[model samples]
Target: MAQRADISVTWERWQATPDGQTARLFHLTNRRGTRLTVSDWGATLTSFKLAMPNDNLRQLVLGCDTLEDYLQSPYLGATVGRYANRIRGAKFSVDGQQYKLIANEGENCLHGGEIGFAHQLWDAEIIESIPAVRFTLHSPDGDEGFPGNAIVTVTYTLSEDNNIRIDYEATVDKACPFNLTNHSYFNLDGVAGDVGNHVAQINANQYLPVDSESLPDGSPVSVEQTAFDFRTAKAFNQDWRKIVSDQRYRGFDHCFILDQNDGSQPVAQVRSGDEQVVLSLYTTSPAVQLYTGQYLEGTRGHNELVYQNRDGFCLETQYMPDQPNSDCAEECIVRPERPFKHSTTFAFHC
Candidate 1:
């Protein structure tokens, strides 16, 4: 019989919030030397490192060195919530009543308004039984223009097999549009370098096209003969110029409809440029946003690294973007009777 992997978790006071509250950082480690550092400040993941065969540590996720840096960074490894992506026109109607949201990105509400969950301080505790850390937040009714007093919890668990499981659960007192996802920019190369050479495959046959505002323009379309095709393993730069010219975007910044949204298998796999490390993503969400760090060209990251374009990629699994204004709005609406729950896992192989 295979032995069970031993796991452990620890926490330390990292910094103080602007509100004078103490924010803590939790470390979840496994016997295999895989370590994940998360902070309660935003329920954000600061770092994920794997122990390579050469006794060297390989960092997979892009992050900042300090809490202040994270506050300024673009999501980084933070948890995005209320709504993962954008909501059209910064408004949505529920039960014959129209609600308006704060518009942070053009006329759309991006990532649940300006003060989304990513900027909130959460209460965190270590769950010894499952060897995980649970971060919880309470969002009052009308917060961010969402009509609900919601209690949300995000738990991160590390397993012996080098899988980091993220479980999200939320309950709302009233009907509201709810969606959450982790915006972790991954580069299996262990450094925030160009991921154009990294081989990747996404289990999505259809993709959503976005307009100049990065919002869904129309219905989903086939990716068979387009630059968005990643049905098979290929380097990100395989159709780099084609994507730039055809899509009119700097790089990949689109949503893909997963062929299988059941979370039974990995929906995406990315290999390191050196072909030494691999990351497999499994999620219960229906779609995954593929963003190739186009705007991160001059951003500074951990270790004083100045990130260039396509330095890392994010596979954010969640409901379709602008779903609240689309035909599938019901899929994201959380009622008092029906709560919100989802799980996403990132497995590292070296």
Candidate 2:
């Protein structure tokens, strides 16, 4: 069995960090009996348990059992920001001024910096009216070498219809790169099996190709005849090994430009092999990055399960990777005058 959930919508102190701050957890339940657990540590969605048709509950996302496990985990269920994906060569020019960022992934930066918003402690509030946890963080100017004081807010709300909605809003004092997204690895079959048989359909006709280093090639390419095509529903592992067999490539790390997106319609849909559950992803963002967790190597997870490669998959809805360097059509810059607002929802159903 997976970790039991607290049915009561209560906020409790989960752990006391050595740094003197407290990590809190807020448990939320919807009218349909779906439960969601969020942590204040990174504004992370720790657990998303859906009530199965068989009258049982199943944990749908990959998460850690403890705060310690989350500290060691690689961006699992965390709200990553300042910037979400790669920044290209650890540098980008904003308003004719070139800024150098911390390089955490080889010579390139990945998910903010060496110490990103992912590991930061956020101020949490449980809104009684909506049954949501609102997390706010203030990033001072020059934090992680970024050139602006950014005030960011992320809210996790569990709707009565079993949709896990994430609302992100941010404002920066100066023009800077601001792409925020949740990095939650989802496996509809719980954490017991791989996601090979998971059926996925993405509403995208083109995808952003990448270079050898996994940086965007500054343009978009058609997904036709390529394994990157998920425009139609198909088994996830179908032709997966043949696509990523070279070992130099991680599976499905490319970004798919959402088709006919106006932020209201779902951009992608995924289902378990047994057809027991279906997850619909709706986002305001123009693109969704599909990563198959090709490098998921860890010893600990829910139920003490050792997570292996391809055990989970991430549907990170965001602008695009290396936004500043790429020629993506969407605007990735957020400034004081023009704030950034984006929302993503994962609607789960059986």
Candidate 3:
């Protein structure tokens, strides 16, 4: 782990809202020529710079200008948690006991309730370079209508192999539900427009469908007859716009139960236009939430302001949501004694 003082740490004030909430940006760059910009506001990774095979220059992640835009930008390279996805009814039962969570996403608790990990000022330190800058935060018992005081650590590592690896570890003092994921809206083509043209493939045969409120129901179903079949390279927009009338989301936003024999396996691989960019995902988490930026509103990224169902996408790695209260979970990860550890690496290639 990289230590706080080992790397050059610099801080800059981004902006302050009229309500007194302010956003601070922290820059952590290392001797390896890697640069990472994170905001204390949400423990959010505002910018990630990396070298491209085509050019010696570093590239900026999908990002927008302005603090309001930064805060509003759900995909501004941030690790969201406590519980990353939705829990049905804003309540779940664990160990025969009932617990009510903060209902932020309609009738459900989406992403650790309203003030999920994305909306916090995390305490951070650069662990002196074993290869990560660890961001730590304490989620007090019942902070978001959930239980337990959980200590969470999210480590960002820029490996020498040109891989950006994210390692998450958390431990709760009590039994509660927890799932974490990074909500980075990716536009492999640099926000030109619509991932409809990109080729993608997921190693999942079945996926969990949700009700109108985006809550997963019952067991995993085959993606066979539906537009969810992503077992091989398929265009995101090709099937995204073809969802039936009954589906609530305009685009894809569902969890695909992964076939993990040993955890941390390749769940999906994405290829951009012209095969200029290739991205692969590896995770230990039981599920991966594939979102096509269906509800992405406003401007950002390389080409133009992102519109609904426009540029950008997400592949979240984590356990099944609503697992705390439902038996529908493929794997219930939250435990009192075991240390919850999840590692996801995004390998970028030409």
Candidate 4:
């Protein structure tokens, strides 16, 4: 029989929040020298150090050295929830009742309002059998103007095959909108430079057209003969010059409707400039938002590195944004009988 990988997990006190809550970190490592550090504050992945060629270790995600840095931007490497994307006008009608939400992003509710799951304190437990850390949170009724009392759980599992699997489960007392996703900005070259030469291929023939407000205007449009085309592997920077010249939007902030919304196979692939690393994304969600971090500024990251636009990119796998205002709003409903369950896996190769 094949021997199991020498995987082990260690938990240590990271710091204490101003509210007197204790925050901790869970460090997981395998025999192959791959290491992952996750914090209990928001079930955040602080660092993902993978073994590279020439006997080196590279941190694949953007992180900070102190908790204060995380407080600056809660979405960095954190799990976002309740509703992963935006809701137009900060309001949505559910069962004939118009519910108003906290408008954290201008006139819209972005990423589950101001106090999303990414800023919550979660209870963490290490599962020895699966070698995973499970985080649970209980959001009371009327939290952030959301209707239901939600009990949510997220599991972060690292396998010997160099795959990071994230499993999410949630149940609500009443019907509400629920969508969850991880916001991890990736720099496969370890933040060496801008991700201009990274090659990407998304299994999507069409992409959502956004309005000036960055919300989906209507149905998806074909990527054929457009700058959004990524059906085949190609350098992302090939057509970036023209995109930047347009004044409507800067970098990528659009969602691609996956050819297959099922989680059966990988829907996208990204490779480093030197082709030394590869990242594959698989998700059960219907869409994946490709954000190029255009507005990233004034934020400091690992090793005192200054982050700028295009420093990293995000592939947030989740349901379509502004669903309640869209044609397929029914897909966003989550009831007691129909709990929320989704899985996304990011497999790395070096």
Query: For each candidate, how many residue pairs have backbone atoms clashing (under 3 Å)?
Result: 0, 0, 13, 0
Tell me the TM-score of model 4.
Answer: 0.96
Return the lDDT, model 4, position 56: 80
Candidate of highest lDDT? 1
The Cα RMSD in angstroms, rounded to one decimal, for candidate 4 relative to the true structure is 2.2
Per-candidate RMSD vs. true structure?
2.5, 3.8, 3.3, 2.2
Compared to the true structure, candidate 3 yields what TM-score?
Answer: 0.87
| Candidate 1 residue-wise lDDT, 1-350, digit = tens | 33234887878888777788888889888887888999998889889989888877888888887777777788988889899899999999988889999888888898889999999999888887787899999999988888979999999988888898999999998999999999999999977878889999999999999887888989999999999999999998888777566543357889999999778899999999999998999999889999988887666788988777778999998998899888889989999899999999999988
Model 1 steric clash pairs: none
Which is superior by lDDT, 2 or 4? 4
What's the lDDT for all of these models? 0.88, 0.85, 0.72, 0.86
lDDT of 2 by residue, 1-350 (tens): 33223323678888876487889989898656788999989889989889887768899989888788888887899999888989888899877798999999999999999889998899988776665789999999988889888999999888777888899999988998888999999999986567879999999999998887888876888889998888889988786766655753336777999886677788899999889999999998889999888777773788788788778899998888888765542399887899999899999989
Weakest lDDT window of 10 consecutive positions for candidate 1: 241-250
Clashing pairs in 2: none
List candidate 2 segments past 4 Å from native.
1-8, 247-250, 328-330
| Model 3 residue 45 distance off true place after TM-score fit, in angstroms | 2.1
Better of 1 and 4 by lDDT: 1
RMSD of 3: 3.3
**CA shift at 23, candidate 2, in angstroms?**
0.4
**Residue 134 displacement in candidate 3 (angstroms):** 1.0
Per-prediction TM-score, please? 0.96, 0.94, 0.87, 0.96
Candidate 1: RMSD over Cα atoms? 2.5
